[model samples]
Target: MKALYFTADKMMELRDIAVPVPKKGQYLIQVKVCGICGSDFEGYMGKTGRRTPPMIMGHEFAGVITEAPEGGKFKKGESVVVFPKPFCGTCEYCKKGLVNVCTSGICMGVLSADGAMCEYVAIDEKYLIPFSPEKLPYDIASMTEPLSVAYRAVYKISDEELQASDHIVVIGAGTIGLLVTAMLSYRKAKHIIVSDTQEFRLETAKKMGAHTVVNPASGDFEEAIKKATDGKKCDFAIEAVGISATAESSLDALKIGGTAIWIGNAQKIVSINMQKIVTTELSVRGSYVYDFDGFKKCVELLQNKVIDVSSMITDTYKLQDGVAAFKALENNTDGKMLKVMLEV
Candidate 1:
């Protein structure tokens, strides 16, 4: 088997490796498609510490069960999408179904667990969610994880707040942000506004049903959003960029008593105006990845065409070109690449 690994010296190297053998209660997955996430790019640029040196970095992926252990629930040739978050089922948090925050959990590709950036991976049977290859393509199935993040972010919003005419702003036009707006559109939310600094992403947002798209670099983001709403602030906001500026802008653009659902995890320390949060009686909540039910919901949403992400993929690469794929993400100065997939 061949795998793309981040070397200790800070570069993606494609190397030949032995195919993994599944342990007890595990299945050998022949990885079909793997999407390089934003975090993967961050790791490539040495921005994140989660992906240490010489690690396989990919969590958003789909594969087929090639070697299932005897008595396994699934069989060989069955396609599935992996719930890459490893958790201890006996933990208190997992027992309460808050597996997203599982204290004893490990996020594959992001943390210590090796991920699906290779041709084959041995995954525990518990984390595999079976799907039909005919109904959903491998690349789209691979999107289950990231789309689940967007689904959870919007799903966390109060149902009473999703008025058909309520003003909403998504403060980033990346994949999660775009999907957040897509989910908003799916639920018939009105007055959707997507803000970003890139022209291509804003265009993609517009296509995804953003009622308005504003380039934050063009002018004051909050002011532009306010102008769109006749000087009124958004009733809800989702901060998809984890920087201090975008995180603060979510509060800056919200109406009195509004809520902001934060979904990004790029930076550690971010400064916000506590005065604005208190004075406006606003609520800012941090949303984690989805629980088991939410993950299933995202899959159903994708299958039902409720959240069409067919246009989300910007490029594809063979495993042999994996290094070039990561390089494309790193050198994406034009902001043209939205999602890059590796065909393993």
Candidate 2:
């Protein structure tokens, strides 16, 4: 099998490697499509230390099952989507159903474990979900991870007693931001505002159902958001960019008593106006990756065609062109990139 491997010198190389055998209680999947993620790019650029090099680099993926446990729910040669997160079900966090934050959680492709970049991956049988090819395409199935992340963000809003179609603001117009906007649209948000410095991404947001797109680099974004909402402010604000500035922007866009959710990976710290938060009675929270049920719900949504993830795929590259795909995603070249997939 040919795979792209991260090297000790921080390089990507395509090499032939031995195919892995499925152990007892594990299922082997022949990789069909694997999407390049932002975190992967960060690791390649030495921004994130999750992957130390000499590792496979694909987690968001879909494939056909080549092997499964006897009498398992999935059959050999069955099409399916892989849930990237592997949890130790006995952990305290897993006991509470928060598998995403489990202390012993192991994520394929991004961590120490072997990922899906290769032609085949052997995963735990319990982490595999049967998918209908007629219902969901392999390319779209590769987006299950991002969609699940988006679902988890919306799930956090459930405790606030907010209604669908409420005024909402989503900061950042990247992949997650765009996907989150689509999820919010599915929830029937009446007014959805997306903010970003890049005009092209903002335009994509509009096509995806954002009612308003703001360029924060040009002027006062908070003022523009307030004016658009008639001063009532957004009922909910979600920060999709993993940075302090965007997090603050999300908080600033919220109305009094409204809630704000941070779903992005922010490595640095951002100062918040504590006085304003207290006086306005605002609630700010952080949301991590999806729980077990969130991944299942994401699969259901995709299988039902509730969200058009197919359009999110901007480009596809062969496994040999993996380096090119990562570079394009990193540079955002031609404004022609969204979900870049490796055809393994």
Best candidate according to lDDT: 1
Pairs that collide in candidate 1 are none
Off by over 4 Å in 2: 8-10
Write model 2 residue lDDT over 1-344, tens digit each, in one string: 88888774346888899888888888889999998887777777777577778899888999999887887778898998888888888988889998898887678877567688889888888788888988888988888998999988977776345464368899988788999999888877778999988888888898888998889989998899888888888888999987768877887898888888888784556777888789999888888878878898898998898888776788999988987777666677545587788998
Q: What is the C-alpha lDDT profile of model 1 across 130-218, one tens digit per residue? A: 98888888999998999999888997776776863379999999888988989898888878999998999999998888999888799
Q: Write down the TM-score of every candidate.
A: 0.97, 0.94
Candidate 2 displacement at residue 270 in angstroms: 3.3
lDDT of 2: 0.83
Reference-based lDDT, residue 95, model 1: 92
After best superposition, candidate 2 residue 308: deviation in angstroms? 0.8
